[model samples]
Target: MKKNNSPFGIGGNKSTVSRREFLSKSFKATMATGIAMSGFPTILPASVFGKNAPSNRINIAAIGAGRISRGHDMPGVWQYDYAQLMAVCDLDSLRAEDGKKLINDYYTKRDGKPFDGVKAYTDYRELLQSKDIDAVLISTPDHTHAIIGVAAARAGKHIYMQKPASLTIKEGRIISDVVQKSGVKFQIGSQQRSSEQFRYAAELVRNGRIGELKTVYVGLPGDPSGGKKEEMPIPKNLNYDMWLAGTPEVYYTEERVHPQVGYGRPGWLRCEQFGAGMITGWGAHHIDSAHWGMGMERSGPVEVWCDKVDFATGGLWDVHGIFTTAAVYANGVKMIVSNEFQNGIKFEGTGGWIFVSRGDYQATSSDPTKPGPQAKKLDASNPKILQSVIGIKEFHFEISKEHHGNWLEAIRDNKSPIAPVEEAHRACSACLVHHIAMKLKRKLYWDPKKEEFKNDDEANKMLSRPQRNGYQVK
Candidate 1:
């Protein structure tokens, strides 16, 4: 975290009325009412009054300055006119400085002025204490997610929490409760819900276009393993102690974390102390899609089964390398999750089957697995599936083609976004439970309504991990 110095960013000293929306609405009304500016023309050039600019922007602070912040979340927030990157907080000092520089550069180019008001902080608590910020984007590691989210909610800031809501089931439930109590618009980063491919596939199931959905297969990549435990001196400009805050204290290693100033993948994601591996990371995406397709966004599996799998030993990173989990819902719906299959959710219904991923969508009249992997890749069997018309009384959806758009709209309307906090908890719970099952290799029955196991003491105990020393979420 960088030392705080001279807090307020661009719009700190003034409170001005927002005229952007007012002008847009007035523009439309003027056209409708045959009104004109000064009676010269029906509409004037928008540039004459800076109509393209945002009148009011919500001040925002980013909680993490890692790869996601630099690569995805920051860029996504920048695309929206309703948001302003006012501050950045990261344990990595160099990343924090870089984040602030990026914000300054972006706004300077847009506003035609040298803007250097963006603040930088090493401690998130200090950032949360600011009254200027209206919201926060949390892209921290899994263990730190719940704590920051809970604190941000208590501080009365809207939040955009990334996938895998928390480190444990208990943490997720607490985050859900806190977010609801705060009445803040919480949007989970399960952006697939806003994508056309996933939306169409889910609607097909929800509307019974795919009659009586039977089996859903979610394919996620394997977790990393086998990093050395060689202790090394902490890298300069990196706060190793703060990075390990809320996790067990350990000797610092390059492979245990990431280079403070590097642009490659971080190592904390593969360590159990900081993350639950792809089971929760990628699982949050596909499983949320499955839940959406099955109309179980507020519910989870009734049973989860996994075979015994060995975790990587003799290394600092001990997360699972290879494993598979099968979850069964109450309505006889089965979902097979593994890394062996193609990376996506394959929806097999009685009528037909469809598969959806980030950049891939396919449909088939026969079994998707029938013609084998090669033929399945070559033959686009059910080309007509994309043209299937959704009639009245069929599954309808909230129209939000872009994820960030829905979040901003929800903030304005105080309405629930497509990926609300409770829905996120349910989605993340599946991943947590799957990881637990893979560890125990048990036939566990889940009571989704109660969010617990059915009289299974051992399984229930696994719902929450004991927080190390001073790491508890307040």
Candidate 2:
């Protein structure tokens, strides 16, 4: 099968290239220029030269060079001494070029040496072709996650992609299938899994610290609120069509793609065509934490019910604006997902309860013996819960403080990262079903093992969306 469109230099030709041939030649080129004739390749990635020296560094590239790249992902790569940024890709030509400048400048100043000639491309296909890049950080919108991810996995590049692996549940399945078959190290950007507070809460629940986990509340931020945005001509530097690669072609508007002036949050985040709104936008993190705490990362709720499903009052954006979704799992545990609270997860057990979000956690314990629980009436002023340690033989989740760093180490070690692709798909699937329930405004039973709605063809059909011409995943 033919690959997707290529960049200007590669053209329309779709010639098959073996990864071995590409990497063999690339290694030869790097080794040929070894410094001081030491025989060891001196062209090490910036990832290996920092405080932690004498380590093999993996080459990396960024797929979506947007606000997140500027603010988080790209900078995050520079944090570790075992990963290097070699290229950046974005539909917007100006942003792609600008990202190259930013990445190179950071290295030049920090390393006290000129790091020049960073490659930038408008098409991700071209970027993925480079054998120099051992992995890719994909922060594209939800609609493109599955297609880009499956392609990167097939291309044999380790992937650290943002969460909600798919806009629809079925596409999530497709991603799961490919990543498992490819056996590449993959981490979903649900960073909660990497943090101490969230991981500790999950461990507490799994170890029965919260005796018999019975209920979970995953609080996600609500959708953005704004009046309709008027359509406008596409900016010369921005490639609107390319940005809408997988979704249906639509009129161009600054609000639909991104802000015209600065690298702020992209407007596609609020549109149903590009995103599933805040439910998956933020739910991907908290809900994944909820799943982990309840010991349901591999499985999902069996039934779901959503109400108060809303869309923005009047805007090109048509994703759900306000909603509450309740799900029941096979273990008879209830999970409530809503926009009623700040972004976080709360687990309630018969003996204790705990609520944890970014940077903080609260706990109360009915049993005086355990110090790690949140009390119903008192604010969490006690430090014992936060300091509680897991005993030997108790459940201990993988210790990963740095999210991107973990993926880099996993890539070098040829192992799965903390948030592998399947767990990401399952977590995203749980959040996606709420969209289905919201649309039908009814209760639905989903067999997670079967990945289908029970005897409900109408709901099952909503599991996938129609792909635009020239963008099918195949």
Candidate 3:
């Protein structure tokens, strides 16, 4: 693939590169690097590099280099030698340039050669078409994940996308299908699955340490009331059209587009057209953990009741003023996912209960009223309750390392990621059901296997939305 300097280099704006140029340049560069690295007593023939060369380091590009990209994704990818940051894309030129500087500085500080040829793009499509990029990290707003992810898959790039994978049910399905068809590896940004404490907690629940699970309570911040706000001019540096891709075209407002102030209250959350409120944002994480722990990654609730009054309200609220929602699984198990409560996952079983959050994990089974076994001391070496309880210290350590390392290994081996596209779609589907039920102000029955509403036509209408002309998912 001949790499086109245009659409990516100095004078490039937003434009697509020819596929033929992309593939030929990438192949030539890869073969040259392989031959140079494989020097021996006698030079191997060029044919040896074909279909037999070991996979080289993957070149990664990041789309939507926002706050989370800087805080988590960039550092995570940098930690692995098998991946290299090649390009960064953002609607705001300033943020995109800042990310490029950050990556270059990291390499320079490490006593390695600085990234002299790293590219920057104001448009993600241009980055997607670059044959140099093997994968993309999507840390954009919740609504844009599906469109960019699908496009990246079609362009033959693997993806590491942030959570609440899609803003709508249909979008999630479309992303899953695209990845499957393209044979691209995908890892959703639900990092808790890669955490030691979380894995132990999930293992304990899956093994019935807490007895048969009766119910799970996953709490997140509440929903939005779509409150009124004043409109402001779009910043000069921002390309508002690209930012609103796949979303309805509405008048630009500072609160909706950029963070003139702090990130306190983003305007996009209050609008039904561009955001999924808290249900798809924060709920995606907490509820995803609940489903993971319950061993329901492939399935979700069969019905959702939206009249539940568990949500935050009033002018005091930061993003959306007020909202509430609840979901019921087919086996009579209920999951309450709302911003109304503090962020965490609580499981109540017949034997006892366990609670876990980002901060800590606690299990209460010792009865003070009656004589019982003495409480064991905390194991500092393992520090995971499930391992400590079962005396399986070795398993604990291995699981901890494997979870985080799994994504990198998957990328190198071209295998499905730990939390792959299908699983993410299922988690997002559960939240989408709750969002739809709440919007229609009614209880809705769902057919999980079919991925549709059982009988409600009005509720099913919210499954997918009409896309703006050029931005529609194919």
Candidate 4:
């Protein structure tokens, strides 16, 4: 790992090594161990004679079975043989039932047996307390991720939480600290890190194929502005009071409560209570890819500048809807993250610039000598590059499947996740810095070691928000 020299380095101690230095060392260690192990012959130990290893299936309790959980995490978890869905929990009874029925139907169709013993609950804490559950999947709103994740960790269960991992910078840090202390496996929902496409991109940057990345441009959709709206009666199945856990209470509104399926109205992204706007929403995934590629997952930018622009009335939300912001790292790397640009990421290195998005990967310079085949040939041994060279197909569902499988493997092997809590926290912290810059409308210097702004009390205060009386994130 790179040595962190910031005043607020890991474990609250200053270090001589830079963040890049620390990551480089860690990468070397990982490569040495992994490559060496790959060469070992596959032989059974004499201790077990010829018996096959026992199947260590992880029993998972899913907290907050909302739309994302149902559409993404649920299927991923059910499809993996290393894990089984033991229970489902959500504030909305209908959503919980929907998730339960889906899992049961899947198991019945796959194994030709009635899948019973799957419990459902409205309270996540109760679900976490179940002895049958060995791990938990948290797909709650942004505000409740830390609460449920921390509780699960304290209960001696591994966690799979959605991004952004925490609603605030301090909460993100606290989650990292708690997970470290607990010694439990914690995986953030930034599955892109485990995706072959993203991993190859990051490896290219790390292996110098991209030649000392100098700038990273990430295009996000936009921030939440809590646009003007009318209050509506709380839905019958949803416990509105429970849904407001860990957030400031606001009157229930149809737009904010239910996700829009088709055409009529917009979804909850317009509200500030449930999410961090698009910055924390989609930005969490794309910005995380940028950070991973830039080799800056352990630290963030030292300064941020906001370029505010008024939103046009009656338009769909975009990343720059709230405001546009640019962040500059201490290492001279510049990141322009706003909803204004087309959705994607660009890396400008000394040798050339490469652009990657959900759909395409190409270089700005097409010359063969500038950045063509030579760039692709930079790292022949790197697994990421080898995978790409061997023609690993790329698709969103495939990436999600691979990421979920990695998490399950990590649990069985007692290893860290592909996107561990600490790295995810740092990525989310970078996103939070953008939010702070937009709120202040100024370029602000940051002291990462202290986890605060350099001489700005007002900016520092934005690091965390006041928790509701019973929902503190401890």
Candidate achieving the largest lDDT: 1
lDDT at 330, model 2: 94
- Each model's lDDT: 0.78, 0.76, 0.69, 0.70
Per-residue lDDT over 206-292 for candidate 4, one digit per residue giving the tens place of the 0 to 100 score: 666656788887876544444446777787888888778878888876666665232222355545556667787778888888887
Reference-based lDDT, residue 298, model 4? 80
Error of 4 at 336 (Å): 1.1
Select the stronger candidate by TM-score from 1 and 4. Answer: 1
Enumerate clash totals for all models, in the order shown.
Answer: 1, 7, 10, 17
TM-score of each: 0.84, 0.84, 0.78, 0.78
Give a tens-digit lDDT track for model 1, residues 35-114: 54445555556653462333346678989987777777777788876688899999888889988998899989988999
Q: What is the lDDT of residue 48 in candidate 4?
A: 27
Ranking by lDDT: 1, 2, 4, 3
Clashing pairs in 2: 47-81, 47-82, 363-373, 363-374, 364-373, 364-374, 364-375
Clashing pairs in 3: 1-22, 1-23, 1-24, 1-25, 2-21, 2-25, 220-338, 220-339, 221-339, 222-339
Error of 3 at 221 (Å): 2.7
1 or 2, which is superior by lDDT?
1
| RMSD to native, candidate 4 | 11.8
Q: What pairs collide in candidate 1?
A: 1-122
Could you tell me the lDDT of residue 263 within candidate 1? 58
RMSD of each: 9.5, 9.6, 10.6, 11.8
- Candidate 3 per-residue lDDT, tens place, 400-446, comes to 24332556556554444567788888888887888777767777889
